[model samples]
Target: MLTEEGKKRRDALDAEITERIAAFKVEQRKMLEELAEIGIHVEMVNRLPNLPTSDYVQALPILIKHLRREYSEGTLASLARSLAAKDASEYWDELVAMYLASAHRISTGPGNLAMALAAAVAAACPKNRLDDLTNLVKNQRLPHRVLLLTPFKKRRGRDPAVARLIEELRHDPALAKEIGRWKILPSQASLRSH
Candidate 1:
């Protein structure tokens, strides 16, 4: 029923479709081989350490409840107290350190929360904010006199080192002016009464 020209065109189209299918299968097989070689390390990164239960919600509620307190000066005292404890202290030090260290490698895309915050908080280059923070700490440029005035809370939260810093701030007015920075207090009026 087909004319010669129509039959030729149909055969050409079919050949092209077959070639594309064959190419796709070859590519798919390579990807499968690569996956087999690598095994299952993809989901390992999202996991937190030392988790005790399958119910993560149940497991870390106490910790999260303590950390996400209502913002205020009095609350800062409590935050300081928590951060002063060994576990909380380590968390802040590590978290901040990690933030500062990774700022350089990440892209300033729609997905990067830590990078954006780090740049705003530290007044550093946006793309390299983490590097700047890390380098500052490393080179002793990390606001030696950091006041750490959070709107209501410290980013590092309850941690022992933060507690130590708070105690130091209580005695060190020089450091206070060097960094009138805060994690929660948006303005002087917001400093909690009591």
Candidate 2:
């Protein structure tokens, strides 16, 4: 029950989506390859947690602790990005806690794993949990003296939770100095182009 134009448009969109998925898988494979080169192996969970169980909640702290000891900061950051892509909402609180407890091991600069973790927190944590998330980052020295003030532009634009979190940081007196250190480049430009 579709018009000819509508059917054509739908087909085009499907093709585009398929291409995007293929590109993403390539990038993920590269990340996994790099992790392998460093001897950091991930035994992917058979099922990613969708509901927050007490056991799942408890496993996070232990996992983060073990990851920090076993991998370099760069490897840990890459792992965070890969996990965030899995849409693991149930683990946002644990991710924030992990960052707070071991942020010293995370390195800085754009595309930092901490930023990806923050994005997961932004996408998953409810509004009421925003303050807790913000406080954790603040207490952790805002993790490398810079934070992504806005979510990276995507097909859907910025996630609302991350936007709210960014707003919260904007008003914090303690973070005023650290926040000032971040420089955002226009999305169209790459570092090499600048």
Against the hidden reference, what TM-scores do the models get? 0.22, 0.38
Looking at model 2, residue 10 earns an lDDT score of 97
Question: Candidate 2 lDDT, tens digit per residue, 1-194?
Answer: 98999999999989986765454444445444444454444333212233333324434433444344434444455445434422445566676666566555445422355664554455545445555645655563655424323222221123554444544464577556654454433432232153
User: Clash number for model 1?
Assistant: 21
lDDT tens digits, residues 60-158, model 1? 323223334332222222222322222333245433553455445433322242332232234212322333333443333333213123311243344
**Candidate 2: residue pairs that collide:** none
Whole-model lDDT per candidate = 0.35, 0.47
TM-score of 2: 0.38
lDDT accuracy of residue 190 in candidate 2: 33
Task: Specify the poorest-scoring 10-residue window by lDDT in model 2.
Answer: 148-157
